[model samples]
Target: METWGFEASNVAVAQVRIEQQLVEAATRAGLTNLRVTTDSEVETIGPTQWLGAEVQANLLWTPTFAFLDALAAWPEGFRVTGFQYEMQPLTPLQQEAGMTAPTGSVRIGVAFPVILPPTAAAPAAAGAGS
Candidate 1:
């Protein structure tokens, strides 16, 4: 096997796409007051180029089964590295608003391979000088 490890250049775009998809999934699952943030990075795994990011989101309540199902069906190249959730105590505002359910925070780590277009090797780089 050969190593095609390379730097990923489309990190920003990938992060935005991930955030959008997460938001959409939350909406579809009826998760309200959704707030999200993402931190993006790149990594090389053998012959693959990957973008790694952590998506942190705060919701009014815990995630539902529908959201988990949607995540399971995420598109190819989208890999779940980690997932965690924390239940937060209700704030004064929430209590005042008659909300009984505690707020929840979720963190999802993901890594997706970057599919790059193939390029023709230069003559000099292809052993022409040898």
Candidate 2:
């Protein structure tokens, strides 16, 4: 195999897309100097859910007063969950698990993402249940 300039995983791609969306929205809304990033891992979430997918977005910026006020009052699904930051910088186990095949190892995490919309999820959910 080959390791080029970072071949992003499914979750990574999703995170990047989400980041872009947020950034674009913020930019359009006239927010400045904000940075958003996301990453996912289930094993470290505790209680180990095989079918669970968790995404963590780190918003690293102290917004201006106007930006904050605008963000608070703005509508149209900001969906930030929370404003406070969480410290989830990739554990060693997670790094190891990501690098290896999951046949004989044990670092529990979600293998695939489960996205929304009844139409889109129907087929995949049905197949998965079977």
The number of the candidate with the highest TM-score is 1
RMSD of each: 8.0, 16.8
Off by over 4 Å in 1: 1-9, 59-64, 89-100, 117-130
Residue 60 displacement (Å), model 1: 6.4
Q: How far in Å is the alpha carbon of 44 misplaced in model 2? A: 12
Model 1 TM-score on a 0 to 1 scale:
0.57
Residue-level lDDT tens digits of model 1 in 84-108: 8899898999999999988777766
Best by lDDT: 1
RMSD of 1: 8.0
TM-score of each: 0.57, 0.32
